[model samples]
Target: MEILQVIILGLCLGFVYALMVSGLTLIFGVMRIVNLAHPILIISGAFVSYWLFILFGLDPILSVPAAALTVALLGVLLYKLIFEKNAAQQTYSEMTVLLTFGTAMVIDGLLAFLFHNTQRTASPAYATDAIFIGDIFIPLAQLYSGMVSLGIIVVLALFLKYSEFGIAIRATSQNRTSAELVGVNVKFVCLISFAIGCALAGSAGSLVSFVFSFFPSRHWEWIAILMSLVVLGGMGSLTGAVIGALVLSVVSSLVGAFYSPAWSTMVFFLALFLILIIRPRGLFGIRTD
Candidate 1:
């Protein structure tokens, strides 16, 4: 029963992790830029939720849409002021790394100055609530987060499948020059994609805050995990991200249950390393070029 409970908990947590990785994967799919600042943007969203909760007693879930919209606008501004300008002058990949790294540092400094280095948590009344099914206990917060993550993934998949702008974004991602030639506004598509990516990050961050305690400088740890998940899933594959998160979570949970908690973290990276060795492009990754 304990093992079963652990597996269920891990899957719920993994779904949240997938939501974070999906944002990174989406940006990579369209722009081929890793956007190292992705974690910083997530932290920014967390802070936004924190402030909103602190100021008005609003639920983190309730504040998520506003935070996501704000982050989306910030993403557009970033694309306009930095990425778009740099893309014109040099290789997009290199510039993306440099610019995003710098942005990450800037965000970290600002957050540290404002929020301090201590851990912060969004503790709602139901944070510690749980449910029992047969002999297993499940956390209510984790279940809620999982459901929200699933809903977001469904909406995103639908958008990409049926929306006109989403189709344009996909076309631009597949072939930017050809897309532009065919009357798609490549620049606009890139900006919109970036915004959508950041918005997803914001929503995920808001949801995650309900489950995890966060410090101002904690973004790097999450960044490393997210990057590994994205790479293991395939640089730009959404479904791959979801699968990678599940695989890593299940592996980590089983290891922690059978071995030591300390080994759980290492297990994820070990799995990632082994997967890369066996399948260089990842489990579901399709070679674009």
Candidate 2:
């Protein structure tokens, strides 16, 4: 029963984890540039939700779209100011990494200056509330967040598969030069894709507004684990990211249940190492040239 409970909780949490990393994955998939600022964008979303609830008495669910769109707008500005200069560049190896990392630090520093590195949590009464069936229990906040995560993933999948704009995005992701040759506006695609990616990070943060305690610098704590999920899943692969997140989340949960909680943090690193050793491309990752 305890193990079953652990698995259930792990799955729920995994959705949120997957959601957290999905934006980063999508950005990488489309641009091949690792956005180090992705974590800070998530932190910004959390802060937005926090303030919305604290100052305006809005619900976190309502804050989702608000925060998402706000960050998406910010993402556009970022693309214009920072990524645009290098837009025509084929590879984003050293300079892009440095730029994004620097951007992350600047965002973090600004937040720290304002929020003072203090842990701020959005308190909605239902955050602690739970649903139970027989002997099983589920936290309402996490469950709602998980549902939102899954819903977003479904919507994104549909968009990519059906929408004309999404088709263009997909074509660009597959081959930017080919997409441009076919009359697709690659620049527009890149901008929209970046916004969508940032918006995803925002919505994911809003979902967890009440579930996690966060400080401005918390992005530092999250980025490593999130990156592990990306690497373990095979960078830029949505399915891979989700599967990898589920596997790592489950492993971490089980480790905490069966072993010392201290060892739970090692689960991700261990899982990544094992997966990399076994299949260098990850569970479902396929690199395209």
Candidate 3:
């Protein structure tokens, strides 16, 4: 029974985790740039939701779209002002790593200045409520957030599979030069893809607003978790990211149930290590060889 409860909780949490890393994966898939600032953007989205609730009594769920749009615009600005410059350079990959890391620090400082270092969470009416299924209890916040995350992922997947722009993005991901030669407008695709990624992160953050306490610096912890999920699932693979997140989340939950939360935190690294040893390209990553 305890194990069942833990698994249920973990699965719900995993959905949210999947949403959290989805945008980063998309960004990597489309642009091949590791947006280290992704974690900070998520926290920024959380703050947006938090303030919306505090200032206007808006529900976190209702705040999601606004948060997503706001962060997406920020993503556009980042791409236009910073990422676009050296995007064609030979050192683009290595440069983006440093650039994004710096961007993360700047955002962290800005958030700290605006919101300070204090932790905050949106407290909706259902924040602490839970549904009981026999001996198992499911937190309402987690369940709702998980459902929303899943819904978004489905919509995103469909869009990627069918939409014209989506096809362009996928083409760019597969081969930038070929996409350009086909008149896919690679620049526009990159910009829009980055924005979409940020929007997803923002949406995830809004869901996270009620489920977890957050501060600007909390992104440091989150980035590590997200990177592990991305690597475990195969960087840039949306399906892989979700699967990895679910696997890691469930394993972590089990570890916590058997031992302590602190120990559970180590599960990401351990799982990542084992996965990399077995599959160097990640579970979904394509092998060039």
Candidate 4:
């Protein structure tokens, strides 16, 4: 029963983690450049929910869209002002790494200045509510957040399958030059992809606020965990991200339950190492040969 509870909890948390990395994976797939500032945007989302909850009494769940929108606008501004300028540079790939790293530093400092690094969690009234089923326990917050994450992933998948913009984004991701030759606005696709990624980050942040305590600098830890998941799942594969999140989250949860929460964090690195050793392309990574 205890093992069952742990697995269930792990699965729920895995869903949230999957949603967390969706944007990161999307941006990588489309732009072929990692946005190191991605985690900071996620933290910004948590802060957005935190502020809304404190000032307007809005629930964290209700604040998800607002958080997503705010960060998405920020994402657009970032792409237009910073990334777009370097989009055509021959060194764009390497440049983006430095650029995003610098951007992340700036955002981290700004958050610290505005929020003062205080540890906080957005706790709605239902935060403490739970469901019990024959000795199994499930927290309402985790259950709802997980359900919401899964639903959003499904919607995103469908949008990519059927929507015009989604088709364009997919085309650009597959082959930028070919997409442009076929009349796809590659630049716009990049911008939209970045925005979508940031929006997902914000949405994940709102969920994170309820599931865990967070602070301005907490993004450092999250970034490490998520990057590992991204790499483990395959650098640019959304399906891989979800699978990696589930695998690692369950491993971490089981370790925490049987061993120590302290060791659970190490599971990410261990799994990453093993996966790299066995499948360098990741579980779902495309073969390059």
For every candidate, C-alpha RMSD to the true structure in Å: 1.3, 1.2, 1.1, 1.2
Return the TM-score for each candidate structure.
Answer: 0.96, 0.97, 0.98, 0.97
Model 4 bad stretches (over 4 Å): none
lDDT computed for candidate 4:
0.90
lDDT, candidate 2, residue 109?
99
TM-score of 4: 0.97
How far off is residue 274 in model 1, in Å? 1.7
Residue pairs clashing, model 2? none
lDDT of each: 0.85, 0.87, 0.93, 0.90
User: Residue 266's C-alpha lDDT in candidate 3?
Assistant: 96
**Tens-digit lDDT track for model 4 on 1-289?**
9999999999999999999999999998898778888889999999999899999999998999999999999999999989988888998878988998899999999999988988898889888999999999999999988988888888888998899999898888888999999999898889989999999999988888888888878888888889889989988888999999998999999999999999999999998898889999898986532
TM-score of 3: 0.98
Q: Write the per-residue lDDT of candidate 3 for residues 1-289, one digit (tens) a residue.
A: 9999999899999999999999999999988899899999999999999999999999999999999999999999999999998898988978889999999999999999988989899999999999999999999999999899989989999999999988989889989999999888999899999999999989999999999999999999998999999999998899999999999999999999988988998999898888889987799985532
> Rank by TM-score, descending?
3, 4, 2, 1
> Number of clashing pairs, model 3?
0
User: Candidate 2: worst 10 consecutive residues by lDDT?
Assistant: 87-96
| Residue-by-residue lDDT tens digits, candidate 2, 99-149 | 889999999999999889888889888888999977989888878888888
| Highest TM-score scorer | 3
The ten-residue window of minimal lDDT in model 4 covers 280-289
Task: Give candidate 4's error at residue 117 in angstroms.
Answer: 0.9
